[model samples]
Target: MDVRISVIIPIYNVERYIRECLQSVARQSFSAYEVLMVDDGSTDQSGRIAQEYADRYSRFRLIHKENGGLSSARNAGLEQAKGMYVCFVDADDYITEDYLCRLYEKAEETNADMVIADYREVEEQGNIIVKELGQPPRQGCMDRRQLLQALTSVGECHYATTVVVAWNKLIRREIMCRHFFPEGRLHEDEYVIMPLLLECGHVEWIEEVVYLYRQRQGSIMQSAETAMRHLEVLQTYQNRIALCRQLQEPELLQAFKRAYFWNIEIWYYLMRTRYGVESSRLYGVFSRRMWGALLRYHHVFGRRKTMEYVIFAISPEYYLNQYFK
Candidate 1:
């Protein structure tokens, strides 16, 4: 049978988790798929573990490169992928047995450029924290307008933002190749996923919990040293806002403002609690941007949140205290 899907696993120093992750992919019920294990110069035994799988499985290919970053590794996999559809799976996370089968079937059924599967976030010890994660509010095949609406709607706990993540979607190889992940950037998913979705003429959402995302403490998203880098999200959202304006999408523009504001609000609290003096300096810069966006799109903020952000602009400490106290 011809290769139908390519599973790209970007490996770093995830020796502790690599075996389990690879095993999950190897056991997928779907048979017509190839696995590309891109080892980004791992210092641990991750490369060795991946090589063993490659040796054992004829379809598994191991490619090694000097340590770049997550984006670099994924791009490397993309360079060598032989399948029509591509699915990204992080080295530290595993998937359910039917993950590929379900996503592939959905894409075929809907003739979609992308198919998004729901996931579960779990602790390292195997306890699930969030279930049915990343389900779009709407189900079945969605057009570009419907998909954008679901993605831009930042209200009600923001259902589709988690779907923006790379690992949970099966994308047509050509669509994914249109916009590669931005190398050397944190939150790189923010840079590419939305743009890809916007370009897709057809997209589909399935409710199955296929991917299991591990919420580990020392990972890039959780580490204290890299936490400050999340400020990059502000710039990412700004780019999205510009795109909305260019597309003449007032609904998207307004929704992106609320989404942008929500992120800045989060980063402000994180910085004040963790970085102290540096937080104040950054907050001054962030506050100006926040106020500017709010002025243009304040209709999306509503009365209560607008008042709260006003307090945040004047006295961050006072606004933060409302949460702590």
Candidate 2:
């Protein structure tokens, strides 16, 4: 069958929610789509359960592989995807019946290389928070520079800002296959999305909340072992700077620098907490590059928060205690 869209769901030990996730896909009004259940070496019944779906549905296929992280699982699914467009879904999250249809519609209508939709966060306590994750005037498409600006928007969290999530986006299979998430890294979205967007000619943002992001306490992101994941984002932000420089886009570079300072803020937060060891290692690296960061993002200090980063560059301890306190 000709697959118009490929839904790649990476599952590992999510037996409790895998059925519901698959159910959402089954509910979709759109056909001509294939589901790749990447059973990333789940020890629980998650793998077996997905196998059952494969048995029942002609479109659902299972790829059993070694216990690689999320990126590895996604990469495996991507390798086998035979679709015009692709989107990712976490095993624990569910989507609306119209999720794929709406995103696919936008892509088809605009001939966009990428289409981003807003999502609602469903907390464990049954509270749902609707998030407008993209920049405003959200119904239109953005060019390369506009996409960069939206991504680096100054907000607590929105679309491309802190909301650079991969799951809510529908990307052309051709564009997606050209770039990939780094294996074994938390916040893989941060590193992957910008480069992908840079290569895309247009990005369409629809304000529809078509996705349900389940926030659970037991998730890998909430685990203490991966708390140090915040530390790895430093490299991602630095890589973004390099990416911006490569494109020779001063405006985009400035925008990315503003976002990179957010990484500095996170490092300071980690330093103040018990995760000091990981933070300290980042601190040394930041210290050596302090002058460079200062020079690179100096234009952004006109804002109050960035002005604070001026002092943060001097002392992580002081920034953590006084200004950030």
Candidate 3:
């Protein structure tokens, strides 16, 4: 029988949450699916729990490997996936029973290469914080231009929408197979999401909340290492800027330049708060590059916004603490 969807879940030491996550997938309303449980050298009971599911469920297949990172585990899953569409789910996170049903129906309806759904971040105690969309305020089919606009949009629209995340979306296997996650790297999703979307001739968004993301203490985003690893975002955005420029896409180039500047501020704050680094030291390093960017992309910001950035460049600490406070 041909499987409609291949769910790729990278399992590590998520012993505390593995059963719940697997149970959610097992009970999914959509049955024409196979679950790929790629266990990345888990020392805890996570592997055992996953194996139990594999033994009991005909569609669940567990593959164990050495302790590669999340990206490596996901790549392993992709290698073995045989379904038309692929879905990524973190081992520590689960989904709604209708997650696959809704996403698959939308993909088939639109003939879309990719279909993204809404998700929510939940406390370990299961308290809901807020519901989020992969692409917000816009639904139905999306053009490439629209996708680029959303990708480079300001503030919460970037990561808060979870558009940069791989797990919240259902992607066609052929398109996904062409690209692999960057191994042993943070922000690996950021690197892959853009390329994946750009490759899709048809892309779509749905409003249903399908994935439940758990915010926990030891999670990658919550770790102190997140501060240092955030440096990786620079490479991702730089590559994006180059791609936009190479494509002669002036609008996307402008958007990426604007996003690049915004990212500097994000990095600065994280460095200060998470790493205990002083703002003064960071200011010296970032100000020079920011000035260069401001001059190079002066047309993008115009008079008022350029002046704001100039003032920010002059005294980022004061501007951030005073205005952002």
> What C-alpha lDDT do the candidate models reach, one value each?
0.81, 0.80, 0.83
The residue pairs that clash in candidate 1, if any, are none
Mind giving the per-residue lDDT tens digits that candidate 1 earns over 217-317? 74533444466676776788788887778778787678777777776666676676655435556666666866776677678866987888877777666
The 10-residue segment with the lowest total lDDT in model 3: 218-227
Summarize candidate 3's per-residue lDDT along 146-204 as a digit string, tens digits. 77767776555533356788999999999999989999898798898788877899988
Best candidate according to TM-score:
3
TM-score of each: 0.88, 0.87, 0.89
- What is the clash tally of candidate 3? 0
The Cα RMSD of model 1 versus the native structure comes to 3.1
**Considering every candidate listed, which one attains the maximal lDDT?**
3
Clashing residue pairs found in predicted model 2: 133-159, 134-159
Q: What's the C-alpha lDDT at position 253 in model 1?
A: 76
TM-score, structure 3 vs. true:
0.89
Kindly report which residue stretches of model 1 are placed more than 4 angstroms away from their true locations once superposed: 130-138, 153-158, 218-225, 273-278, 294-311, 322-325
Off by over 4 Å in 2: 130-135, 154-156, 161-163, 218-225, 270-292, 295-314
lDDT of 2 by residue, 53-108 (tens): 99999999999999989999999999999999999999888899999999898899
- The root-mean-square deviation over C-alpha atoms between each candidate and the true structure, in angstroms, is 3.1, 3.2, 2.8
Sliding window of 10 residues with minimal summed lDDT for model 1: 150-159
Which residue pairs clash within candidate 3?
none
